[model samples]
Structure formats: structure tokens, C-alpha cells
Target: MAAAKIKKGDRVIVLSGKDKGRTGDVIQSLPKDGKVVVDGINVHARHTKPSQGDPQGGIKRSPAPMPVSKVAHVTADGKATRVRFEIRDGKKVRIAVKTGEVING
Candidate 1:
């Protein structure tokens, strides 16, 4: 699998879709699928029947994964930019293409 530019805990901005222009922290990244689950973005309500855990049936809102192509990494200055990988001090790192800040901590 190829390395993903986005990672958990990184702040990102949604580029397209109904959630476009929204920014949130990346909760998870699915590199194989090229999808990402950002906090408070792309939420969907799921209806569920009563199960073993809960007796009452209700609707639950959950975060759905969005395509990685639709999200851009948000830099410290609040601009959305592409990310690139580079080696610094003998360690591989991800950095913002615009600001050149180390993104992967």
C-alpha cells in the first residue's frame, strides 16, 4: 500500500460535496479505499432496530468516510494545501506544500 498523506489527528478541509468548506480533525484515514473520516463531517443518520446492547430502537448519526481526493490538509495559517513527503534529519516526514511545515508528528 502507498503511504497516505492524511493521518489521524490531522486537521483537514473538505473540498467538495455538501460538506465543502468545512474543516475538522481527521479521525481516520483509509488509504486502501482512498477515504477519510473527518470529525463532524459527512455525517449520516442510520436507523437501527433494537439489539442485544440496547432495547430501544433509534436513529444514530455517525461520521461517514469521504474520498481523500475531496479533502485538503489545512495549514497553521488556515489555508488548505497539498502535502508532500520528504526526509529531514534522516527521518521521513510529511509536509505542507505551501508552508513547508512538518505535518506528520
Candidate 2:
């Protein structure tokens, strides 16, 4: 498997754009595309036809995928920082650069 710096459920902060400084959990990880969708961030409106769930078919707010460069991993100390890999017990783990703490997926 490829090493993806960010994983699903990771708390991240937007580094730039309209969602700058906003923090949210990673809802999905598009590792192949190097883009992760964060909950409640990068939202965009979508128009859909009437479905069984919603007959109104009004515009719904959905999160749009943003480049991985626009976000950074949030460390345990509540700081946005870069992620690095470290080997421990023969297993590679993601470590937060700011606090040197292991991040669990």
C-alpha cells in the first residue's frame, strides 16, 4: 500500500482558501488523487433532480474536494503541522512534526 500522509478520521486544518484556519475531521481519503475531503469544509452547492429522499430537489450543500496542499494535520497539541513517518517496532507510523506524537488512524 502507498503511504498516505493523511487518513480518514484525521483532524485537519485548512491552510488556505475560504476555509482557512477551519478544522474538521477527514471524512474521506482519496489517496489515489491525493485529495481528502474534510467534513464541513470546502462546501459547494449541488442541484439534483427529485429523488425518493427529497422530492423538492433543491440545492444541497456538499463538500468539494480540495488539494492536499491546502490542509495540514492537526497534532494533539491543537496545532496544525506537517506529518512525518517513523519506524517503531518494525512498523511505520505517522508522527506529528510539531509535537513528535504518534497519530493513530
Candidate 3:
């Protein structure tokens, strides 16, 4: 398997879709599906009748998974940047292409 360019907890900016121009932390990463879920982004509502799991299963709002291509990592200066892998001290690390700074997980 290839290394992940984006991972959970990465601060990213939406490049397209209704949430474009918005920035948030990555809530989940679905590398297999090439998708990710960002906090407070791409939210969808689910309405369900009262279910056994919850006595009041009303409208539930939650973030939905979006294609990984739609998002970019945010640098320290708050600008969007592409990610690159680099070998540092015998360890592979992610770097921000724009700022050339190492990104910590």
C-alpha cells in the first residue's frame, strides 16, 4: 500500500463542493475509498422514527465523507498546500509543499 498523503487530524481546506473555502480538521480518513470526513464540513441530516437505539431519534446531523481530492492541507500561515513525503533521520515524514515545513500527525 502507498503512504497516505492526508490523514486523520490534518487541518485541511475544502477545494470544491458547497464547503469550498472552508477549513477544518480531518475527522476521518478513508484511504481505501479515497475519501475523508472533515469536522463541521459536508454535513448531512438523517431523519428517523423513534428507534430502539434512541427513544427520540429525530434529525441527526453529522459530517459526511468527501473525496480526498477535494481537500488540501493547510500550512501554519493558513494557506492551502499540497503534501509531500520526505525521508528525515531515516523516518518518512509529511511535508507541506508550500511552506516546506514538516507536518506532525
Candidate 4:
């Protein structure tokens, strides 16, 4: 397994699709699927019928998992940047390829 380039809580920009150019924080990471769910991104609507558990069942909108390749890490300048691993002070850290800065985990 390889290190995760994108992880939960990281801000990212969508690279393609209807939500392209939009930025959001990573809500969940699915390494097995190579996908990530970003808050307010790739929202999908699901219509549901009323069930006994709930009095009213209506349309639900939620962020859907998108391929990790569709998103890139956002730099402090708000530009999308690729992530790279580097060892500094004997600790492996993620580096922003654009600005050569350390990314906060």
C-alpha cells in the first residue's frame, strides 16, 4: 500500500466533472476504492418513501465518493498542488509540489 496523498480534513479542489474548480474539505477517505468524499462536492440526491422509522421521508442530498484522481490538494494560495512525500527531521511529511511547503496533517 502506498501513502495517502489526500486524507481526511485536507482541503482539495475538484479537477473535473460538474464540480470542477470547487474546493472543499475531505470528509472521508476510501483507500480501498481510491475515492474520497468531499464536503459539499459531488452531491447526489436520493428520493425516499416514508418509512415507519421516519414520519416524513424526502429527498436527501449528500456528498458522494469521487475518484481521488479527480481532486488535488489545495495550497495556501488556493491553487491546486500535487502532494509528495519527503523526510524532514527524520519524519515523513507531505509536501506541496507547488510551493514546496509542508502540508499540515
Instruction: Say which candidate scores most in lDDT.
Output: 4
In model 3, the runs with Cα more than 4 Å from the true position are: none
For candidate 3, give the lDDT.
Answer: 0.95
lDDT of 2 by residue, 1-105 (tens): 669998899999999999899999999989888899999999999889998989989889989888888999987767899999999999999989888889997
Local accuracy by lDDT, each model = 0.92, 0.91, 0.95, 0.97
- Report the C-alpha lDDT of model 3 over 1-105, residue by residue, as the tens digit: 788899999999999989999999998999999999999999999998997989898999999999999999999888999999999999999999998999997
The candidate maximizing TM-score is 4
Candidate 1 similarity to native, TM-score = 0.93
TM-score of candidate 3 relative to the true fold: 0.96
Ranking by TM-score: 4, 3, 1, 2
User: Could you estimate the TM-score for every candidate?
Assistant: 0.93, 0.91, 0.96, 0.97
Give the CA lDDT, 0 to 100, for residue 104 in model 1: 61
lDDT of 1 by residue, 1-105 (tens): 878899999999999999999999999889999999998999999999999897897998989999999999998888899999999999999989998788866
lDDT of 4 at 84: 97
Worst 10 residues of 1 by lDDT: 96-105
Q: Candidates 1 and 3: which is better by lDDT? A: 3
Judged by whole-model lDDT over C-alpha atoms, candidate 1 comes out at 0.92
lDDT of 4 at 86: 98
Which window of ten consecutive residues has the lowest lDDT sum in model 4?
47-56
Off by over 4 Å in 4: none
